[model samples]
Target: MITNFLLDHSALVPVAILLVALVCAVLGLLFADRRRILWALAGVSSLPVFALTLVPTVHTIDEILCTVQFSVPTLGAVELLANVALFLPPVCFAALASRRPVTMLAAGSVLSAVIETLQALVPAIGRACDTNDWLMNTIGAVLGALIAAGTAWLVDRRAQSGSSTGAISS
Candidate 1:
């Protein structure tokens, strides 16, 4: 299955993700508006997230097992902020790039859930699943969506009022 392949070839997964992102960017570059480049970046901006969570960095485990019971998030400020930061870029970019920011929010939330679930279900990966991480990630996604929505509203208002960016006669 695809999951087995990704787990076995951890190193190649990043390469493949980057390659896809590159392809998306190139296609976006050819678009008339070229806003799709934001979409491409938004999706792949999770490189840090994938690198930190998916890659097995933890060492010397007491038992080679996965934690099924999801516990409360007890990580300190730094770790908590890092988790939130990880999802912010991708979701923000996705929102700015698309008219439907909700899709980006949903994608970010689902992405976090899937990552946490994988960590809990797979013991060999050496990652711990926590509800806290998911919560923070979802928060970041929501913030991104909200920011984009506010920006869109401002743009619409400006257009309706026939206001320009302080332009002068040519």
Candidate 2:
């Protein structure tokens, strides 16, 4: 029933996937020291989101030819927000894995560019190759990376403070 609902409302697919990713990310926080769990969860949850992004519909090569356009005329604020939301998990997970903001940002931006390029080059994919999506996706990635990095930093700082206080008390 849930699958059918998501299929019927294609826009809901990414939202659903994002929710699942968030759950995994929260679970990952429990194992903050071992980032591998975060990576695994994000990777596994991201598969469906990736598939949804590449899902083939009507063959429309016309969109691919216009991939350089910075703005999508048909897209509204909601769509742009959704684009950003869709990529948050992987970006956050990448940050957790390395705690490197630059690495996470680059990875997210590169991944978005690659996906857009693939959509443009592959006619059968039926996905629109829009530069706006790349922009939004990159923004999402950076945002997620910042969030993860900040959280990790806070955790480390708290631990350090606690250890120091303990030492002072001793």
Candidate 3:
């Protein structure tokens, strides 16, 4: 029964990895006073999660039953978007939490590509190491970093306005 379930939801591996990373990031943030270290761990955890997502598998009956089919363009787009979307959360979180958008984004992109390359080495996984995926994922990390920067700016602006008004100065 378990084997059947595993076959049915092979994609769960990546989801599980992502969950673990999220937990680790949260725990690290809570325990580590050093924001830099926490952000670094968050970025590191995101790499394995991204790679697990890229691991391919032969279409088993369970996969078909689960309606896990991708059209060509759709698959292509997913390949492209997955990198960015998958890595964005970690990058954004690190940037927001650490206030280091550029560093976190760069680190996340490099770590993501390294994970993808490592996954390519495993034969049964069926995923090829595509340079394009690396590029798309990097773009995603950059976008996430920008988002983080924007959030920081908004927060700073709000704080400044709040202090100026002094709650009843009007």
User: Could you say which candidate leads in lDDT?
Assistant: 2
How badly does each model clash, as a count of residue pairs?
0, 0, 0
Best of the candidates, TM-score: 2
| Candidate 3 lDDT for residue 9 | 63
Question: CA lDDT, every prediction?
Answer: 0.65, 0.71, 0.60
Clashing residue pairs in candidate 1, if any? none
Arranged by TM-score, best first:
2, 1, 3
Q: Tens-digit lDDT track for model 2 on 1-170?
A: 66566546766655664674565356546767887877785687467558867888766665445357565422235556566766777777767777786787898889888888888888777787778888888877876777677668777887899999999999
Which stretches of model 3 miss by more than 4 angstroms? 1-48, 54-76, 167-170
Flag clash pairs in model 2: none
lDDT (10s digit) by residue, model 1, range 1-170: 64466556555554543454344334333331446667677657778779888887655334434434433433334455456656766776677678567998998999999998877776667777877788878876876666566655655666656655445322
**Residue 116's C-alpha lDDT in candidate 3?**
58
lDDT of 3 by residue, 65-159 (tens): 11123332232243454555566667766877788899988987887677556555554555555666666667768866776677667667867
Name the 10 consecutive residues with the lowest summed lDDT in model 1.
Answer: 23-32
